[model samples]
Target: MTYDDLLRRAAALARPGHRAILGIAGSPGAGKTTLARRLVRDLGDIAAHVPMDGFHLADAELDRLGLRDRKGAPETFDAGGYAALLRRLRDERGEVVYAPGFERVLEQPIAGAVPVPPGARLVVTEGNYLLLDTGSWVRVRGELDEVWFCAPDEEDRVRRLVARHEEFGKSHEAAVAWVLRSDQRNAELVAGTRERADLVLTAAQLPEP
Candidate 1:
């Protein structure tokens, strides 16, 4: 429906005692991060944000593996490690856990950038491949209390993606080329996993700024 509905749904998950994880899954530019952050911000101290982008493989590692060109593809991420972190976040309730975070300008992951204190009862994790049922990614869903998919208008999504790349250092042409040649392929793959999500949210369903 609207942001109010999402807020209510998220609030219900952050109950007393046990911790809860709310996963937001979608393709690049579908606004998963935007939605996840908004939920955490609105939910106040009970929620913490842990993004999947934080799990991206370093450029050096990608170069060594000959995957430098396919940076945003699922193969370029530490899927197993991401899954393991999710498991820890879900199980380790009392400690002050830390999670990695990604820097868009540097296109690198920063370790221990996010802190999830014991007071945080909910963790909002957003990513592209959370719903993927392949390889180590299959372990992710088991750790989440609920997963919601974001499916925005295609034209708008592509536009935002291109602008994001351009904002991060790519030229307009390079950004367009990357979005069409690489991101689009990954987007299609993520789209296929939509049916597996507990709920699907569209542009109109997201929060109003």
Candidate 2:
């Protein structure tokens, strides 16, 4: 399917009386965030983007836990907190719900950053572990109305991931090493959950940002 078809399907999930949450799950560099952002932008007022990256554990906390090196791993995030927020979003309690936002430059999560107004009928959330069945990640699937998985070509995904790391201040060599070591492991884990998704998307289905 084309990107337009995906948009139409996502938009159709929003009924007049019910709120829907659409989850975009993929490995690192699979373009989950890009797709979610595009969906929200195209959907406009009826949709809101609430990324799971917002639930990343603080850098200090990561150091305390000794998981700083595995920053993008599932364990590095506050999985329980993320699940709780999704529950709150699903409940639609008629209040403005505030979610954290991750700053790529600072590599920290800003608290109460993204506000989801009560009027929004569709919530688009994207992240790596959304489809994972481990621990608190299992709770995420229940809250989401539908979850779509994205799988681009492995070489392209790795290239994008390396470029992203370099753009965020890592040296080219360091970015390549990080992608091969840290991000690749996380990607493998995420890839195992592809079968659990409601739909699987490919690069052909995505549009350029």
Candidate 3:
């Protein structure tokens, strides 16, 4: 889909006093966050980002659970907490609603960093597992007005993941290793959920508007 197409869909879903939740789901390094950021930028202040990454368990917690090596795996995140936040952000009436934000430097979820004021119209939530059929993820789909799956070239996605890891302080070998062993596995799992998306967009198809 084109960028203009996204804008139109976002606009149609924007209603006063109604929380609009749009899910952008894709494989690791598929530019899900990049697409979400662009949508939020185009949609302006009426839209706020509430990423699924914020549900990631802290590195220390992962270590305590003996799942540090599988950091990005489906079971490594707080899926229940994420689901509850989505429900509250979409259903409950409140003056101020707060959501967790992921800290890349610390590789942990920092509580209450994203504040969704009482009147936010659109919430662009992106993540790999939003469409997963497991557990609470089933409830996630029922809450979204629409869901778009972003697909980039597989090679490009892998390269981006490797580059991202290297930029985040991992050695080249470690970056590649992690991307192949963990990130790629997660990617495969997310990719399987494409059928659940309302639209499928290429990275280049995003419009400037």
Candidate 4:
């Protein structure tokens, strides 16, 4: 289906008195963030964007645990904290709720950077591990009303992933190496969870807002 078609379906998720959450899952550089931001923008005041990148462990924390090399892996995140935030978004409807945001250049998570107001009927969150059925990650899928997985062309995805790393401060060679060694492994894990998604989307299926 086209972006417009998905927009209509997303809009329909909001009811008179309930809040619904839509999850966008995909491998690194699959355009999950782009699609999610566009959908929330098109849906206007009814929607809010809450990206899962916000749960990334700080560099200091990663260093302490000696997991810095596995930065993008599922273990590098505060999965339980993310799950709790999702649960709060689903149940605490009376007041404004704040979710964390990540800074790409610094590669750090900023706390209380995103606000989900009471008026927001739908929350659109995107991430790589949304569909993972392991450990604390398992709690993620249960909170989302429907999860959509992005499946872009492999070559295109790799190109974008490499470019992103470079844009955020890595050298060309370093970016490519990181993409192939680290990102690729995480991508494979995320790909395995695609079948569990309610819908699968391609880059062509998503349009600019």
Candidate 5:
């Protein structure tokens, strides 16, 4: 579908009386964040963007758990916290709600970085494990009105992932290694949950990378 098509569908979810939460799920580098931001930007004040990356555990905590090497894995995030935030966004309690945001430079989650005002009728959230049906992740799907999966070409996805790592200070060789090892594993796991999404989209339907 085109971006305009997606925008119309998102707008439809916020029909007459209720607020809605729309989720964008995909493997690493599949453009979930890009699509979520585009939806929010196109919809303007009616929507808000709340990313799941904000729930990533701090680097020091990852080090303490010996999970620093597998940073983007599902286990590395605060899944329960993410679920709670989604619940709050769904509630739309007539007050502003704060959500965390990830800082690429620091590679950490910054608290209270995103604000969802009371007037927003839609909350656009994107993440890797939104359709994952294990442990704390099971609570996620129940909180979202619908989840869209993004599936980009595998080669392009890998290239984008490697470039992102390099952009954040990793050497080219290290970036490739990480993408092939850690990121690829997570990507494969996320792919398994694709069938559960309400809709599936491709990179072509999103903004140019």
Candidate 6:
């Protein structure tokens, strides 16, 4: 879906004296983050971002658990921690709450990067496993006011994912390999949850440059 349409949908869901949380879920290269950023930008200062990537396990923790190679898999994140943050967001304690954000260059989640002020009108969260039925994720949908699943063409999705890995320092060959193995697996899992989303968005139209 176009970013403008998403923003308008979110705005309608927003209410005075209440917080609105929207989930943008998709495969790794389906533009969930891009859509989330555009929503926040279009929604202006009252909007905040709270991505699920922030709950990724530290590199050390991943190593200890023998999950370093499966970094983007569902098990690699702190699902419970993410759930707790969602709970706090819903509670509306009137105090600013801080959450981590993952840095691609550092390949880790940096603490205190995403600050969700208590009074923000909107919280736009994007991630792969938000709609998954396993673990704490099952309760995640209860916290979101709306959930949109992005589904780009499969070929386009794979190409974007390969390019992203290459841009992030992976060799061309390595990028292709990762997409075929790890990324494709995650994509299949994410696709299975499309039925759970409130909206299924196909973002094929590129905005004019």
Question: By TM-score, how accurate is candidate 6?
Answer: 0.94
On residues 85-198, what C-alpha lDDT tens digit does candidate 6 reach at each position?
Answer: 888887864889898999998889999998888667788999998899988888777788889898877888888899999999999999999999998898999999999999
Off by over 4 Å in 6: 205-209
In candidate 5, the residue pairs with backbone N, CA or C atoms under 3 Å apart (3 or more residues apart, or in different chains) clash, namely none
Better of 4 and 6 by lDDT: 4
Once fitted onto the true fold, the runs of candidate 4 whose alpha carbons sit more than 4 angstroms away are none
What TM-score would every model get versus the actual structure?
0.98, 0.97, 0.94, 0.98, 0.97, 0.94
Q: How does candidate 6 score on lDDT?
A: 0.85
Model 3 stretches astray by more than 4 angstroms: 206-209
Full-model lDDT, candidate 1: 0.92
In candidate 1, how many clashes are counted? 0
Candidate 2 lDDT over residue span 1-209, tens digit each: 88889989998998887789999999999998889989999999999999999999999999999999999999999999998998888786498999999999999999999999988999999999998888999998889989999999888899999999999999999999999999999999999999999999888886653
Q: What's the lDDT for all of these models? A: 0.92, 0.91, 0.85, 0.94, 0.92, 0.85
Better of 4 and 5 by TM-score: 4
State the TM-score for model 4.
0.98
lDDT of 5 by residue, 1-209 (tens): 79888889999987655689999999999998888888888898989999999999999999999999999999999999999999988776599999999999999999999999988889999999999999999998889999999998889989999999999999999999999999999999999999999998986887776
- Model 4 steric clash pairs: none
Q: Give the C-alpha miss distance for residue 143 in model 1, angstroms.
A: 0.7
